[model samples]
Target: MAKTASDSVSLTRQAYALTDDLMTPNAAVYWIDLLVSAALMWGGFLLAATTSSLAIGLVAGLISVLALYRGLSFIHELTHIRDDEAPGFRVGWNVLVGVPLMTPSLMYEGVHNVHHVKDRFGTALDPEYLPLSRYTPLSLAGFLFVALLAPIGVLIRSAVLTPLSFLVPPLRRFVKQRLSALVINPDFVREDMARVRPAWLFQDIACWLWSWAVIAATVAGWLPLRFVLTGLAIFSLATFVNQARTLVAHHWDNDGGKMSLDEQFLDSVNVPPPNLASELWAPVGLRYHALHHLLPKLPYHNLGKAHARLAQALTPDSLYHRASQKGLFEALTALFRRVAVKPVVAEHGRHAAE
Candidate 1:
C-alpha cells in the first residue's frame, strides 16, 4: 500500500508538470524571441555607432521595433492567464526582452487586455479610439495629416490622458480594478470619466529608467545621438503602423456588437512586404496576427503552424483575405478613402444588439 501511494503521488506530480508546460508558451519560441530582439537593438546600435548614417540607423531601429512588437504580443498571452496564476514570471520575461525598445510590456498588457474583453471594450470604453472627429481633417490632405500625426495622437491618448484619468476618484477606481494584480476581469473602464484607474506608478518608473539609460548612453558618447534619434524615429513610425493595423482590424465600420475574437482575426489583415529577408524589420510575428490573437501563448515561431490549424478549422468567411507585401500601400489607401464615410463602430459585445 505504501509503494502504491508513492507511485500515485509521483504520477500526479508528473502530470502537473506536463500540464504546466503545455499551458505555458514553448521554451524554444521564447528564447528565439529574446535572441531576435537583442540582436536588433544591439545591431542597430552597432551600425549607428560605426556609420552614423541615418538610413542604417533607421533600418536597424525598424528591426528592433518589430522585435519589440512581437515581444509585446507574447505579453498579451500572459495577461489572459487566469487571475489565480501569478504573472510575475511573464512580466519579468517581457521586461527582459521589451524595455530597450520603448514598449513597457506590463503596462501595455494591462491596458490591452481591457481592450480585448468583450463586455467593456469599445469606442466609448477605449481611450485609443480615433474616430473621424472634427479634429480629423476632411480632405486627402487631412488623411495624411492624421496619419502623419498618429504617433502624437497616441501619445496624447495613451501616455498623457490615461495617466491624467487618475485625477478623478471614480475613474481611478475603474482603471485600478483592471490593472490590479488581485482582480481578474476587473472593470476596464467606467462609462463616466470620473472613475478611471490611476496610472501605474511602477510602469512610470520603468519608462523613466529605460529613457534615462538610453539618454545617458548617448550623452556619454558611448552612442551617437544621431543614431539613437534616427532609430527612435524609425521605431516610432513602425509603432504607428502597427497601431494603424489594429485600428483597421478593430475599428473600420465599427459595429462594436458585431466584433468577436474570431471576427477580429478575420478582419485583421497581415501585409508581408516584398523584403522577405526583412522579417526582422517591422514588427516580428505580425504576419501571423490571427494566430497570435487566437493562441496568445504560442511563441512567434509556432504562430504560423497555429494559423494553419485555425485556417483548417474555420470557414472561409471567417477569415479575411490577407494583403500581400506589395499590396499594403494600396490597402491603406483604400481604408483611408472610406475612413470618414464609415462610422467607427464598437466590436461585438454588450453593444452588439444595437
Candidate 2:
C-alpha cells in the first residue's frame, strides 16, 4: 500500500516530536549572528570607499554582498519567530536591514504565512510560489531578468510609491495590492489593504522616511554619491543572488492545483549535508525548505538538527528523500534543463497531432 498524506504528516510529527528540545531559539546566537552580518555589510561599504584598489574593493564588495544576502534572509525567520522567544529582534532587523534596504519586515510577515498554508501552496493564493516549470525557457529568462531589477524596483517603491500612496487612498490600495508584497507569483493579489495592521503601518512609514532621507542626504552632499551608488550596487548584487536562489528553491512544477501536505513537501526543495555554499546561498534555514513546509514553527538554527533527526527517524523510502538536491548548481541546472526540454517536447506533440 502507498503511503498517504496522513502517513506523511504522522511520520513528520513523530520525527519532530523527538527533536522538540531543539526548537528553542537561542537569543544570544541570533543577536551575535545578526550583528556580524551587519558589520560585514557596512564594513564592505567602508572598505570600498576608503580603498583605492579596484581589485580590493571588488573582493570586499563580493564578501559584503554574500553577507548581506544571508542577513536579509533572516526576514523569513522573523515571520515565524515568536516575540517572546526573541524579543526586539524584528525591530532591530528592520532598523539594520529593512529600513535601509526598503524591505521592511512587515512586507513578509503576514505574506509568507500564506505559502505555508496546506491548501494554498502552489495555488494562485500562495504569495511565494509560481509554476515556472510550465513556462517556456524564454519565460524563465524573463522571470530572472525581472528579479535582477528588483533592487531598483524596491528603491522606487520606498522613495516614490510609498509616500505617494500615503497621500492618495487609491494609490495606497493599489500599492498594497500590487507592490507591498514580497511575492513571486504575479497572480497573488492582496485584498486586505483596508485592514492594515499597526506594525505594518509603522514599518511602512519607517521605510518611507529612511528612503527619502537617504535620497535627500545624497542630493545635499551630506552623503557621498559614490557611497550611495556603491550601497545600491551591493544591494542589487545581493538581491540578485537571492533571486537566483529563489529560482531553484523548489521544483516549480505545480500547475495551480491544491496539494496535500505530502505533495507540498515533495514540491519543495531541500539541500542536505549543509556545507559552506548552502550556508551562504540559502541561509536562515532556507536550505531545508521542504522540511520547513512540514514543520513551519521550527526555528532556523534548529533546522539542521531537525533534518538529522528526521533523516534518521524516517525510512529510506520517505518522501523526504525525494526533495533533497545535491547542491545549488545542480538544482538550477535541472530547472534550466527542464525549461529547455519543454519546447522540444511541445514540438514533438504538435508533430504527433499532425
Candidate 3:
C-alpha cells in the first residue's frame, strides 16, 4: 500500500468511531442462530433426500440449500473473530456446519485477512476478488456454472488428496499452497499455515475421516446412494447461490492497483434494509459489504444497526450512502449492465470471474 493509503484513513475514522460499541459480538445471537440454522438444514436435508413426494422433496431441498448456505456464510464471521473474543464458537461451527459441508473454516480462516489490506483489496493478491464485470457475458455464464464444481473439488481435496499429500511431502506442500484456501483466485498460494498448524491438523483430520466415512458408508450400502447424491446436489446448489451473491458483493471496478482505503470502500457494495430478498441471498451481514469495509470489526448481528446509525448520521453526499444498494435485483442489474458490454481494452489483472 502507498504511504498515503495509511494517511488517508481519516476518511474512515468517523465510521469506525460510530460503530465502536457494536464490535462486541453477542454470543447468544451466534449460538441460537447457528444451532437453529443447523437444525433446519439437517431436518430439511433428510426430508429432501428420503421423502416420497417429488414436490415435497423439491421444496424441502430448496429450504435445505438456503439454510445450509446461511450456515456456511458464518465462515466469514469466523474469519474476522479472534479465539479470545468468542471462545468455542469456531469449533462448534466447524463441527456443525463446516465439516459436514466439506467447507471447514480452515478453508477461509487464515486466507481472508489479506483481502482487507489496502494494498491488496482489489489487486491480483486479493484471493477473494475477481474482476468479473470486465468479462464477456459468455465468460460470466461459465463463471456461474463452474461454481457448481465446488463440492467435487472439496471432496477430492479432503478425501483423495489429503491422505495422498500426507504420504508425499511435496504434494502436501503443493496442496497447502494451492488448494487449501477457499479462494476465488486460484493462483493465491497460502503461506501462513505454519501459524495455524494445530487448528489445521484438527480440521484436516476431521474432514478426511468424515469424507472417508461417507464413502465407506455408501460403498457398504449402509447409506443410500440416493441420499448421498441428493446431498451433493444440494451442496452444489448452495455453492452456486453463494457465487451468485459474490457477483454482487463488490463492483469489481478496480484495475489491479494499490487503492486508498476510501477507494476500496467505494469498490465494495452494500444491499441494506427493506430488501427482504437480500436476507435470503446475502445472509450474515454480507448485505452490508461496503459498510463492512468501513467497520470490519462490527459483528454480523450489529451490522444492521450500525448501518442505520450511519445512514441517519451521515449526510446524503457521504460515501456510506453511496455504498447502499436498494436490493439484490438492483445490485445484480448493475453488475449485469457492467458485463453486458465487454470492455474494449482490458488491462492487466482484468479477466474473467475467479
Best by TM-score: 3
Rank candidates, lDDT, best first: 3, 2, 1
Winner by lDDT between candidate 3 and candidate 1: 3
Supply the global lDDT for candidate 3.
0.84
- Positional deviation of residue 55's Cα in model 1 after best superposition, in angstroms: 6.3
TM-score between model 1 and native = 0.59
Whole-model lDDT per candidate: 0.46, 0.82, 0.84
Q: Which regions in candidate 3 have their CA more than 4 angstroms from the true location?
A: 1-11, 194-196, 342-354
- Compared with the true structure, what per-residue lDDT tens digits does model 3 show for residues 192-214? 87554787788988999999999
What lDDT tens digits, residue by residue, belong to model 1 across residues 1-354? 122334434433433343333444555555565566666655655665556677875566666556555554555545555433443545465466544443444445456555545453344454333332211224323333344443343334344444655577665554434432211112234232233333345554455466666667888998777766655564566555555444334223344343544444444455443435324333445554444444444545544454444445544433323322234455556666665555442222223333
lDDT of 2 by residue, 313-346 (tens): 7778877778898898898889988977653222
Off by over 4 Å in 2: 343-354
Error of 3 at 144 (Å): 1.6
Displacement of residue 277 (Cα, Å) in model 1 is: 8.6
lDDT score for candidate 2 against the true structure: 0.82
